[model samples]
Target: MSAAFSFNRIVAIGLWVVGGGTALFLIAPILAIIPLSFNAEPFFTYPMPGLSLRWYNEFFSSEVWKLALRNSIIVAVFATLLSTVLGTLAAIGLSQSDCPARATLTAILISPMIVPVVVAAVGIYYAFAAVGLLNSLTGLVLAHTVLGAPFVVVTVTAALSGFDQNLMRAAASLGAGPVEAVLRVMLPLIAPGVASGALFAFVTSFDEVVVALFIAGSEERTLPRQMWSGVRETLSPTIAAVAALLIVFSTLFLATIQWLQGRAELQKTHREE
Candidate 1:
């Protein structure tokens, strides 16, 4: 028994080490850029002359950066809202056992995530161009909504796995209409999931570049698009500053998701009890 315990302990330790090392390897580049954003020398290099916020200042003060930031916020917000509504509704429908062609419908809904980004971008560009949506904010938001809705569907579906369908029946028995039952009963219980999905949608839209590249005009340039242009044209430290801010934003976003998941688990446990 002692020998078996020792082996299991060693295995656990080895797994932790491997996982931690892999995570570090993946994030090391992101970690490397954070310090460079603070570099006073105005160029990426080791052994910085000093630390300063000059790049951050430039990012905030530059009109180009300001416009990109505004566009990113607008697009992400609209995409998140639209995707959340559409995805939540789709998830609820898919969760119904009697739903027709469930697997095929699910695949169609999530194809945006499965398809190569460039392929999707090219398709969207051509499709939107036909509708005169090319180079428009509406086009960008709608395209991002497509990309982001799959995440919402997945998250909400997972949340519904723990949900009690009987509650909907109970609401109906209480003379509640379908829409009223969902709004008053189902949504509150699944709030964490819906919120989590919305956050994911926001992040998806905010970080998206390829679709934005195909759809956005100069006036609709997103932060990621601006960063791409900077890399190709100027290659300034302000890019690093923008990247560092994104890292911080992503960290906070992930933390929020974790908290939401934890809350969801707690609610599930209560329901089970």
Candidate 2:
């Protein structure tokens, strides 16, 4: 029995080592771009050259980059608003419903993440062209909101799962109306989850390129569009700079989400105890 247990332990350790190594191998190339972004050389190659912040300064000072950043910010903010509102309402309504098809409804609501971006982009482009919204910011926002709504739904639904139906009923029994109760009680409780979801929605819209490529014209070009153009036009280190910035931004956004989730979990535990 001792021999068998020792063999099992060795196998488990070996498996863990293999998994960890594979993960690092996969991530190393992506992580390699961080240092490349800081290279003093104009090219993508690395050597004994010192690091510099010129690329970052260039990104901020360039008119092309500035315009793209502005457009990206606008789209992200608008998309986040729409996704949070729609996703929250959908979560609440689906949670309340006694229908047997609630699971199916939930699946349908979050299907955008599963569908290929290229396919979705093609469908939306034709659809938008028919409505005269192709190449417009509003059209891109609408497309991004639909794509991001699934993330919001998933996050908000996780929060809603822990919601107290009894509290809502009790509030209704008192002098509180539906809207009032929601504003005073439900919103406060779910605020953290909503915040996290909104952050994700913003990120989703900001980073999205495929749909933007289809729908947004020159006037509405976002940062990723500009990056894509840069890659096609030149193989400069400037593209690496932009990629590094995006990585840092994404890391910060995800950290915020984890923080909110931690806070929510602590609150839940306190209430339970």
Candidate 3:
């Protein structure tokens, strides 16, 4: 028993170390850029330069950046709404054991996530071009909705796992309609999952560049697309400010997900007890 305990302790320590190291590795670049965003020096090089908010000021004041930010918010909002509704419905439908072609339908729905973004972008470009949707806001929103739906489906499906379907039936027997049952019972139970899924969908659409690059016109350029152009055409500290902003947004989203998941777990445990 002592030997087994020691082995488990060692394994736990080793896993913690590995996890910490991997996280640092992934975050090092963003961390490095964030500090440089405040650097007073014109160049992106290292070493002490005075700190200032010049770049951040520039980002806020610039018309280009403002337009890009607006575009990003608009696209992300619509995409999140559409993806959440569609994906939640699909997840609920697919969760039923009696659903026809369930596996095939799931695969098709999630294919956007599995397939290469470049390939998907190319396909969307050609398809939208044919329908006069190319270079349009609607096209961008539709494209992002496709990319975001898979995350929602996966999140909601996980929330539904081990769920007691009898509760839904009980609601039905109480004279509750399908929509009422879903809204009153299922949604409350899975609210965390739905919120997490919607946030993920928003983040995915907001940060996406490749598909936007292929489809968006100059007038419809998103934050990521604008950043891509800035990086390629002009090396500036404003880009660093944008990167820092994105990092902050990503961190907040991650923290929100962790909190929601923890809350969900507590709720589940309380119910079980």
Candidate 4:
């Protein structure tokens, strides 16, 4: 008994150390960005010269920044809509399938997430330029949707894992068609997950700089693209202000998803009873 207990303790301690180190590595860059954003210096240096909102004010007042924010929002909204529709349908289809190839199909669907953004963007940029989609919102939306679909697929897959397909059958037996069953029965249940996935898709597109950098120059500049340009041209706190705003927005969206998911689980329980 003493030997087993000692072994378990060693395992637990190892896990804790690994998990803490992994978390710090992931979070260090973002935590660093926050402090630098508030630095009073014109450079991306830190000496804690006292925090100021001056950079944020400049970001807000700048016309270029405003336009980039507007563009980013537009692209993100469109990309989210596209990914939500396509990904939800794909998820439902995959879940309903009994084929042996389902795993392969899933891999194909999510390949975008694994593929290098630069390579994908390069190919897309050339294609769009050839097809007159370069420097256009339409091109940007399509590229972002391709990139964002994987997130929607992954989230909805987890949600569907907890779903009871029988409820769908019952609705259909009560004279509902597939579309009606999905909308009235499945959707109300999985809508929370879909909503969360949409939020993630929005974030993916909003922060995407690589594809935007290659495909859409100033004509379709996003907030990230603008920030990239600022970094390359000169250091400015205005970028920090932008970063802070994004951090706040992401935090709020995550909180909303958690609340919605909790309510969804409660509703599912009540229905089961």
**Could you say which candidate leads in TM-score?**
1
Cα-based TM-score, every candidate = 0.96, 0.91, 0.94, 0.85
Instruction: Please identify which of the two predictions, 1 or 4, would achieve the higher lDDT against the true structure.
Output: 1
lDDT of 4 at 249: 88
lDDT of 4 by residue, 39-121 (tens): 77777776777877778778888899999999999999999999999999999888885756899989998998898999989
RMSD, every candidate, angstroms = 1.4, 2.3, 2.0, 3.2
| Runs of candidate 4 exceeding 4 Å displacement | 1-25, 98-101, 257-273
Tens digit of per-residue lDDT, candidate 2, span 60-80: 899989999999999999999
Query: What is residue 96's positional error in candidate 1, in angstroms?
Result: 1.6
Stronger candidate by TM-score (1 vs 3): 1
Identify the leading candidate in terms of lDDT. Answer: 1
Badly placed stretches (over 4 Å) of model 3 are: 1-18
lDDT of 1 by residue, 153-237 (tens): 9999999999999999999999999999999999999999999999999999999999988888888999999999999999999
What digit string (tens of lDDT, one per residue) describes model 3 on residues 1-273?
999999999999999999999999998987999999998977898883789999999999999999999999999999999999999999999999899999899999999999999999999999999999988899999999999999999999988884779999999999999999999999999989888899999999999999999999999999999999999999999999999999999999999999998887887787778
| Deviation in Å, model 4, residue 94 alpha carbon | 1.5
Name the lDDT of candidate 4.
0.87
Instruction: Quote the positional error of residue 221 for candidate 4 in Å.
Output: 0.8
Q: Name the candidate, 2 or 3, with the larger TM-score value.
A: 3
